[model samples]
Target chain A: MTFLNRFAGLRLYAVLFVIFIYGPVLLLPLFSLDTGLYPTFPLKGLTLQHYAEMAANTSMIEALKNSLTVAVIVSALSTTVSIPAALALSRYRLPGAAAVLGFMSLPLLIPSIVIAVALLIILLKFLGVALSLWTVGAGHVLICIPFCMSVLMSRLEGFDPSLEEASRDLGCTGWQTFWRLTLPLAMPGVISSLLMGFVVSFDEFVIAFFLSGTQTTLPIFLFSQLRFPDKLPGVLALGSLILAGSAVLVVLAELLRRRGAKSANPGDI
Target chain B: MAGYGLLSPALLIMVAMLALPIAALVLLSFWRQSGYTLDTTLTGANYARIFGLSDSPTVWMGIPFYLAYPVPVILLIKSLMMSLTATVTVIPLAYPMAYFIAFRVRSGKSIWILLLTIPFWTSYLLRVFAWKIMLGYTGAINSGLMALGIIHHPLDALLYNSGAVTVVLAHSWVSFAVLPIYVSLEKIDRSLLEAASDLGDTRWQRFRRITLPLSMPGVIAAALMVFIPTVGDYVTPTLIGGSGGSMVGNLIQDLFMKRNNAPMGAAVAIVMMAVIALIALLFVWLTGYHKMRARRR
Candidate 1:
């Protein structure tokens, strides 16, 4: 009886915590479907008008395109850069490697707001470069490196170095062995890194806020809209779509990560 | 040689993207500039202005102090407090969930983990905005409460306050806290728990002495991970804090964007970084020292 009681209590607490975490996100879809301008309860009737209007907004569409373009470019660039870094760091020993890795990962610790402000001052003042989409892409690459490195490193670590060695011994060049063995083995990590990097760049706000000139990303567009409260229902509708998309991407990323881990070491799980 | 060549791109990118910007921030902090004009002569006036060392103490200290001081500090402190509260709230809840998943639940650990991570998929801003809609004056919570006859008047305090920000941000970040602690709990040797049971230790006694200490590292990491970023965050405060909930990040934002006072902004940003670094270093050092002392004992 006591055990059952305790289990019930535990389940209750867990459900409440889950509600706290996920309740607001769940509320967005409900409110988006709401008929009124204000996000009030007592739904007058369900309507898709807000979503349709959002779809038809030209500037919002442009912002979405800009965000997508930047995210894709940044993800591709960062993954390409992280691959060799991950490979060398995981596969071989080098001088100051720890320090290099630490430096590379330090951006994760520093607040993005600080980085954004710092970059703005530096890029405009010292380099005399005007803010542009390219600068925003550059900032995304900076922030995305640590995530790419960590994911790639985990994949690299689980891989057996002996496979590459065996391939090399079997009359294959180092380059050829890496292409055939390492690259194939690490593809899952590469894919996860690419997905995660894309999502992060797309969703990132502070960096894009500072670096984007004349071109507004979706997040910045959403932020600008928040000042006007009446437009909030429209924002909620837009937010619901973004939330659904991001959730799908995150799940895909996680699956890729698990797949990478599993393939790198078939014995572990 | 190929490996070195392969590594160069990332290194070069980091140098250009990160290191150069940081160097530029330092330079910009030392210069006196108005709008687009760059003064060739360097000065410490910005730092002086921030520190209230100038003759125009109002610009240096009074105005920003009055207008900007309370919001960011309060928001940072409130967020930190809320994170601590959430951490405490989560420990008891997560300890059992982790326990159930690790030792009790017979199958589908990966599914639960996936379920936990689902919330992270949505854009962070969108999630926060969702909370705004849910907690607003005419929002879901009050409507539900009023429908339930919990109160005649709607709870005006439900949104745009420190409490709302704290609750929502804590919800958003709970997964980060839970996952680390779960990993640590799973690592505990089952035999140790069984031995404690065999030795006739009460369940509570066994948990207090065995499970708790073993999981301290994860708890610490979880707390630090959530606490550090929450302290620096401005988004939650800006969205939910209304006029009262601005954080240090907001001040930095105003300095950069609204005010265009680069030096003052840089000074505030530097100070914010220094404060976080100091706190993080202190936490690590204290934890390390405690571990060493416990080892000696």
Candidate 2:
């Protein structure tokens, strides 16, 4: 009945919401451990056969390699691009910063499918550019920019601007100040942006699906495997592995960001 | 000058990757594609087919009549409907989670937010694919029921329907929906709620009068956030959506990749984007989110 405590039902809803978000994804790992080919109930005993098979699958390994390469490139490129933009936004009163920021976040609002198709058109039809890992990486970078910018912006904004100014007043050049003070302070966000960008590109399917040629990413390979019932268990194994790896990386990134924020503005994080 | 210098690289990339490419796609939509070569001539024929420029139409709900090639238009409508359904379901379910974390959680709100963010940063493909496993023919739901002697046959209705697509979208996007709403709720001044309570207002009355209106920006943002992206989603509809569940994304994919009709595909993509933009702008105008900032200024 109290204003602060009328959420007895809400507490229960929160628990169920967490379950709803995680329960389906957890099913992949649960079924991966089962011996049954189908992801059904009533376990047919536990087995690690699918993991072994996934390890031995040469095609899947090649796709995983390609995905890793693209993800690495995407993470580096997107983060590198975002650092300056985030710095500019955080430090300066740029003209129309809000509108420019909104414009940049356009990729987040538009469908990845539309991005994919449009890129496919431009690359193949207009630019005469071939569909390769480069195009896929480009798509990933566009999608990753808004996220990476926010991460770096938060980190840069949290720290006192006085530090950078102090470095500047000490006769350090702008680039020197950025290198010696700004970049170091924003390191946590830089790393977080890199990891998140990597996970996004690695698991991205639609953009790569539309933009790729002979080269395929792990997700594209997994999607292709979905057609065969025999590959179901292995697909589940791969999916579960991706899910787990992403969770670990994201949690680590979030913790690092929080730690950076806590140190920058003690007590808020 | 320094700010612009620093920002130019990111702005350039967006122009190269987004603006230029989309413009090309838009131009290509006007040009005809016959075989491998694109005819340099611009034409409205592509747009014409979508809006029933020729032939008698199959009318639905006494509106959205299409006489020729109604597939793209129909799928666009279907995808929008499914996305709205998902958005509606998510707001109600997510509002309470957001509300709980905002109003109830005292010390560890960051932990709860982190929990929500973790799923969001994970593979969207894997999350949706997981739903396919749970909702498939011999999926967990049916298998569990059969195991418990509750059913003689696996239920086919659980998957391969618009309902399946809607449910998956709701689950996958609930995390994103929660954080914004949570932030908005957390930002509310406690004094206002206290003010209401002191006036002998009920908790529900306080929420309805103060909390709901204050959080409208987040709710509207959350709705557009989920609805816009999911409307053009390709993976969910294709992987599990059977015939009945295919959205505009699937149709676009088919036109370009399978059918090799890139111009037609471009037209469909443009149409989908236009409709989404209209709806988004209208929603913001209706809710006055866009004007609220300027009004405050």
Candidate 3:
């Protein structure tokens, strides 16, 4: 009887904890649809005015374009860089490999704001590079590379190197073997890394705030809009859109990760 | 050899993109610059100012009103304290959730994980703003309390304070803490727990002797994941910290954007890097030591 009581108690606690975790996020869409300006209860009827206003806003469109452009470029570039790094770390017997991996992961440890400030000073003063979309893209690439490496490294670890060796022994060039055999096997990792990179760059605020000039990203534009209390509803509407988009991307990434893990672990079948 | 060739682009990009910027930050800290003039002339003035070591050489010295300022050091220490407090609070709450998901629950694990991660999809700024609504005067909690005749007036003490910032940030980062600890907990073998129970061990004894020690790696990882980012965060403090909860990152932001003193900003940035690096190294060392001890026993 006591065991059954304790089991019921545990289930109740779990349900409440999950509610606490997701309660506010689910409230965002509710408040966005709310006619009331403030997020208080006692529903003041539903309205689509905020969503319509968001569509008519030109600056929001431009910022969305900028964010999309940066996210795409950063995702492609970071993936290209990480593939080789992940391949080398996983397959090669290089000296100081652990240290190299550790060094690559340092950006994850340091704060993004510090990196942004440091790069802002260094790039402008020393490199004579003007701040633009290119600079913001570069910062995103740095932040995304570690994530790319980890995802790709995990995928590569479970791969059997003998396949590549067999291809090499059969008169296939290294490049050919990599492009044909290895790349196909690692495709899922590549896809996940690309999606993860895009979502992170799209949602990143600190680096874009410091490095962007004339071409502000979506998050920065939303932040500026938040200062006017009257614009809160429209802001909430836009935030809901971003939330939906990110949820889709996260789901896609998880799907790709699972596919990659399943392929790597054939015993699961 | 071709794998090395494939690796060169990434390694080179990392060196140029990451290492160079950090090196420049450290180098710029020692140089004196004024207005638009950035020069290579090195001095200890920046560090002295940060540490409050420089003495004024004015002839009209010995004024009782003059005292060295310790704002930088004080902010750095305070930020560390705040981040540590957040980390400490997050762990106990996270461990239970992670344990429940991994060991106790068998059904709907994916849905639970998905629900846990849903909060991260929203704009981080908007989520923080939501707290302002919930905690503000005449807000949900206060208004609801008054409507129920629980309190006569709205609670003015709920918003724009350290307590508010801590709670909001804790809510924001709960998923981050939970996921890592969940991964580690999931890796624990079931037979080990069963073996403990078979040997006449109490539930608490099994948890302490087996589960906790094995999960230390996840605890350490979660601590670094939470503590490091929280230390350098200025946005939470800026939005919810109001007056009393400003951190070192806020000081860095002020120096860079508001003050327009790039040199001083660089100096503060370098100091922050040093402090954070030291803390990260300490965390890694401690985790390594614990792992070694666990392996021995």
Candidate 4:
């Protein structure tokens, strides 16, 4: 192909590809708005009936509550644990730092299915812990820690050590220095980590599916509802809401992460 | 000691939640299950069943010979094929997009990256369901075609198949491919391209020699990232992939949930992990990832 033809082709491909990624997502709100039960087209006169139905559904509400609970717990637990570890790895000359960092990130590399199965057996067989929201929370913690660590680590690495040194020279204790100076400076990463952890935990499915017994999380509930053709509209409405919520959180997290990175190396910006 | 103390909490959690369970998975695979009770005695039965090397009398009879070559193995192979196909397909699609953002987008590259990742952060279930809706018989594509008088009836071939699964997967996974490749592509010094053009090298030749090699690391990383997760993905296949499109992950899920055979599921899970690990090692070795890192250092 000629260079001009190829350039045009690439642009066309990119546009088509974006459509591929987003077209169906756009359909979600359209179908959710459609008055018909089915997602079929022909402009069935837009109505918010499905969303109203979703609002009235008790089980959907329950599942959303459970999901929110799990996400909050997971985010708090994972971020709290990740911060000190991130601080240690970034601020100290720890032995086996490479291996420790690798260990922290191991969960991200492994498949969710494998982790779910492993956790399932351990909880059910060994610990004798009944499958519940807490099990799901623990699993979320396992997965979210690495992400929290990464975000916090980047933020910590960008921090100016001399600031802490100056605090020490000014007769401040280590705890005071951390609380007064370091923690405030690292606040962006901390917030970003919490948001990232929450989003990850909220969107997670397989682990919750495996670990949850009677109390279904939002995703597990959503997956089960897909089997019922009548539930399609409600699920579509739910999906649209989730899409909007996650989009906002992701954008916010990205902005915070970028802000943290910019502060880390102010010269880059 | 202070550093060690700070690291201990995360390490203990990982060991308890991650390392110990993986160890238990291996041990569980060795334990025998008889009816409702799981006997604590170690046995090679689960492994044999997974590999189709079981020593049951039915093996001698060759009746139900299909059992000799177990479903998990076939499913694993199918998953391998699906992941490989999806990864290969996604590369070409992602490369051009990444190229556009890195080279063509003169300003607001961060905004483009953020936009791409916004969809990435959306629920995986919703994304898969979106594709399912789009490719359904009476779904968007079919309805649009009908509205245009392109066809009378909705196309049944669009959804509930392996092709649908692959297409949706490639679509959902495009961002993962884009981010890494974009990073690598962005790192390409513009001066090199300008110099090559000044030396009368054609655009294609310049891309072939300089751009391609420079971006290979990111491409490889992206491929690994996509391929590994896709291998164990049950969600996409479940939503779009019908019975024929089921992968090892679906089979493993069934073994645990429906079949109530945790040991066998553990075996299958381990086997899948082994396959992923092997593929990852091969990719790392072929790409000389260590060499690349050392050179950078």
Candidate whose TM-score is highest: 2
Residue by residue across A101-172, what tens digits does model 1's lDDT show? 989987877788888987887778777889998899989999998889988999888778888888989999
lDDT tens string, model 3, B68-160? 556677677778877888888888888888888887778878767776765664457667766776776866678668767888888888887
Question: Could you tell me how far off, in angstroms, the CA of residue B165 lies in candidate 2 after the best superposition?
Answer: 1.2
Candidate numbers sorted by DockQ from highest down: 2, 4, 1, 3
lDDT score for residue B195 of model 4: 93
lDDT of 4 by residue, B123-169 (tens): 88888898888898888889988988999998899987777888787
Q: Candidate 3 has which clashing residue pairs, if any? A: none
Q: Clashing residue pairs, candidate 2?
A: B57-B67
Worst 10 residues of 1 chain A by lDDT: A260-269
What's chain A's TM-score in each predicted model?
0.94, 0.95, 0.94, 0.92
**Local distance difference test, each candidate:** 0.78, 0.88, 0.81, 0.87
Model 3 stretches with alpha carbons more than 4 Å out = A264-269, B53-67, B107-111, B117-122, B143-149, B283-297
Model 4's DockQ score: 0.68
Among the numbered candidates, top DockQ falls to 2
DockQ per candidate: 0.60, 0.85, 0.55, 0.68
TM-scores of all predicted structures: 0.89, 0.96, 0.91, 0.94
Q: Model 2 chain B, poorest ten-residue lDDT window? A: B52-61
| 2 or 3, greater by lDDT | 2
TM-score for chain B of each model, two decimals: 0.82, 0.95, 0.87, 0.92
Poorest 10 consecutive residues by lDDT, candidate 3 chain B: B58-67
